[model samples]
Target: MVIFIMRITWLLVASIFHAGPGGYLQYVVYIVTSLGFVRQSFDVIVDGIEQSIVEAHNNLRPGKIYVNNGDLLDAGVNRSPSAYLNNPAEERSKYQYNVDKQMTLVKFVDNEMGPVGSFNWFATHGTSMSRTNSLISGDNKGAAARFMEDWAEQNGVSKQKGHANSVDFRSLHLSSVLPRRVSTIIPEPNEITDDLMQLASSYVASGGRRLAASNITRRIRSTQENTAKFVSAFCQSNCGDVSPNVLGTFCIDTHLPCDFNHSTCNGKNELCYGRGPGYPDEFESTRIIASRQFLKAADLFNSASEEIQGKIDYRHTYLDFSQLGVSVSTSTGGQQVVKTCPAAMGFAFAAGTTDGPGAFDFKQGDDKGNPFWRLVRNLLKTPGKEQVECHAPKPILLDTGEMKEPYDWAPSILPIQIIRIGQLVILCVPGEFTTMAGRRLRDAVKNVLISGSNGEFNSNIHVVLAGLTNTYSQYVTTFEEYQIQRYEGASTLYGPHTLSAYIQEFKKLATAMVANQEVPTNIQPPDMLHKQIGLLPGVMFDTTPIGTNFGDVSSDVPANSNFRKGSTVNATFYSACPRNDLLTDGTFALVEKLNGKDWVPAYDDDDWSLQFKWSRPSKLSSKSFATLEWTIPEDAASGVYRLRHFGASKPIIGSVKHFTGASSAFAVR
Candidate 1:
């Protein structure tokens, strides 16, 4: 349940918050009062309710805020080195790797208890673990969170007054623009030797370590100590056009750079793949990138001194963006009214991004779509003349607004929310906004907050854009970017005037918030919970090799083995589908050390050093096995240890039953 909850939170609404030690009490109150059900989806409900609760808390302490900025992330996808070499100078300049490196830290201290909690914001995609990764890990950001939480627990911060030892409330702010900067392409089958291929296959089948984020977390943990229940949140920002694949894109076949404008190789997108800083070694690249972010953030956290002072306030409203008239300033400083059109994806949207190239012959910067695809798109939902005109220069591919058979394909009604924490304003946008677009929106809102506030706000105001909040509505790009029609621009669901509409609506929200006036909500979004579909099949029944029982050990630790730090202990057991029971509150594997008389748990699957993997011999058979691997940490205690596996099995006609297995005792010295 927790795994699903985290996945939903990360995917649906990337916003997270940590209440002080007493945060659980607030959630209890929220759930009991029925305020938790404010949204239709579980992820949205959590995000919305968290906003309310955090705002409520903000109204109280309204503590001092500090900020620091550093160019730590190489997130701009358009700034790929190969793109720079292939594109014209002017075009290259437009997509320079400009990232939001600002880290805003908010610290709340009780007069008597000293510091109680802290919150922070930064921008980077949580894609250190590539698509090839099969484990259900939180990638880098999650690793950083766990590291900080673990550090707090180990250092006795949880023992402070008013701190709940077991409670660590975290909120994930999904602020990435595109995908992580990591490559999403898999190695070619021909490139793998028989032995190496088998190892690679087994490594995945037997779960692998999430290196990058873990490295960052460990670095920070080893160096920092806190006096309070510190919550370090690596929140995302305007990364709509940003990617983690910093090395750049190249053709796999010829080893040459891909086409700059379209990101294709030999007229094909499939072979055009992006590379990370570590190039062939993705894990090394992840570590390199993670190190950069961790170093910068740590420096900022330690040196941030400017104190932000003001009132805590927020405003939220739902608006129908489709057909909304927006006033824009022309080159002559004259205002022109333009209306936004219905949601429609452009041809380039299917071309994907450099981090993960699209299939077929589709490519980026394609204003004119292929005729065959156009016909295919028409079969799905044809765009009307108005939509075609609204999204000029962008050839429509999927008319999402017109496809409503299985509920709305894309959201037309989006929630616009602005949260003001003292002088820092958080623009909780429901979609990914490109760098320039995000900047324009931030500047527009900041100007409104200052100019329209009538002395209510001043130059000290700071605004941050939080993307992918509350809901997912695809992307938003500048009008110029829309004209270019790259992936980000093409994915801009609304018409070309989309950014303008967002700027206008957000300014209204800022102005209303400044005046303490209520902006009436527009049409509410429909409840599509009933139309939700579960495509994945559930576990049927569990079986093992003919003679082996569910808990029977297939492979055990070697006898008389003397292991040391960094040594790995391996064990395998006949098992059942883990989905039968997620072990939400427990673990599938453990390392138990023998004491004088009793066995003490030294580690569990939750620890980074322990890995649990399940695999079936064949898809046709339900028989399966689980492998447990425990890599001893440098600080491991010298003692006798053994591996343990916990599982649940379901019979064809009987209830699910739990089982346990153990490995031969070994010495770690």
Candidate 2:
């Protein structure tokens, strides 16, 4: 299951017109987890906000957001969009607002931190988180952005950097993924010819790349088609109805309500339309009967009691993979100390997955191949000897987890966290956990909670596994899976007892929480920050042709023009290098609305309807142009709005100076 979410300016919207406790610099942080994806699911809540902003800007009213009250709309003087979107209603609770809110909060944090301050990640899950593919694609996350941006451009939405670049920035996506093993499928045959074993390692890499390309192609095409349908259908239905209530009326195809808020609406069709099973119902039955047992397991969490009410306590700390050692309970009720070695992937790691075929005939899940085993034994010397013993069934191939120089090939220090509220616990694992591993971890956490609470919370407790959270570690599998030596098992960095170690650690954490005692700091993980390496180069210079000045409004809407819902507004401006290099503190554009005497900030680039696109007319020259577009939403009231673009230009001899371009006022009716 792959989940993709687009979060606009949540913090900015929260802090709108009011200081959040500690001025602008102080912002709240929200952590989310995903095994194969993330927290945000495209929903009516966001659509509603987009509409509210449009209406507020159009009507020249106080332009405030308010939660829905049946059919009553709150006019102006509201707190945050959440205040308006989240109300005491059956509909509000069902929108999965809790999950979506976290995503929004993440976006706000991303905006405040800027490009440099935030987690450096790429949307590899959509393509190949394992780096099997060489092609450059944003994968699912990037594709979502492109789809939305394309829609906005086509519909006439202009990009705006509202609130001093505080809120209305572009969408921020925190990329998370299940361990690479889930996506990298290694087929079964349990045998490889000795001749093929003699092939070069590059051949393996190339084979992996080819397979990755094929998988990515199929995924991208299907995802794009599904996304296009989703967007077009939403737009076609004109579902953004902010009147008579604040919540946008989101529907699937032809007015079928899409969210849980209107769960019983006559036109409700809550099934998510995606690229795989659990969508459309047709393939669901067939896949469910065939190889798709993952769906059944998903039901357990989906149906888990959500009646959560208690204190929310969250703690985060790093764990050094090298020093990881813990006493794990054995199958026979005994215990043994298992220590983690430097990160290393077994030979099966190169075997890939069933979904993505590899080159060699060597199949995964075969622990007894004397010839292959001997070949791996000869592949490396001291390390190979140790790895052979360390990763028993699976011979070590790439000792990435152990590579110290050139900035540790893989992460050594990983983020592990837990969020506990009332009887609910969310174990935030940094890597992917197989079905059995996930189930076991949850059971372990529950057992710990049960024991720690002295039976107070055992029967009523709900523990959810949030995998691939905060950062990517790799994969964690049960010892049974490890012995099988499949791709997932081989990728289990710390070895066969990795899952046991995690269970033990998490239990300890839960025990501390139950006791209401100060959480004990386990041995600290090595701070790999200084040792980290970055491949991206800094911006050299953004030069514009000598003939043009920066931020010049080349073309814009008529000084005074009229528009209505579904109409588009566009502005073209001569721009500089964009200096995306100066991300932490920058703004591309802003949309402003006239409020009697002064113009009020209405939208920023972060707003869903707004889009910012920078392009160089010619690669040979430094000259670049920017286009800002805005699509007037259906709910927009009658009023005037204008767009402003901010940018910078650098000269060969002088320092870069910032400049601005303003568009003509256009009326939305």
Q: Over the stretch 1-669, how does candidate 1's per-residue lDDT look in tens digits? A: 010012112222363211101111111211222322222234443565566455544535423445545455453344323322433447437554555555555444455543444455566555555555556555555555444444333433322333333221211112211111001111112331334322222211122211221221122222234433454555667767666567778898999988888888988877887787777765445545554454344444445556666686777788888879999889899999989888888998888776667798898889889999999998988888988988888899988776775456677788888877667788888877766778789889999988988887788776878777766687888787778888877888888889889989998888898888988875898776655443334578987767667767788666556677677889898888886755544677877665554655666676566778889898867888889998776556565667777778889998777777777777665
lDDT of 2 by residue, 379-411 (tens): 542355665576686666666665544444566
Q: lDDT at 656 for candidate 2?
A: 59
C-alpha TM-scores of all predictions: 0.77, 0.49
Count backbone clashes in candidate 1: 11
Q: Which stretches of candidate 1 lie over 4 Å from their true place?
A: 1-97, 108-117, 152-230, 306-308, 567-569, 594-597
Least accurate stretch of 10 residues (summed lDDT) in model 1?
Answer: 176-185
Give residue 419's error in model 2 in angstroms.
5.1
TM-score of 1: 0.77
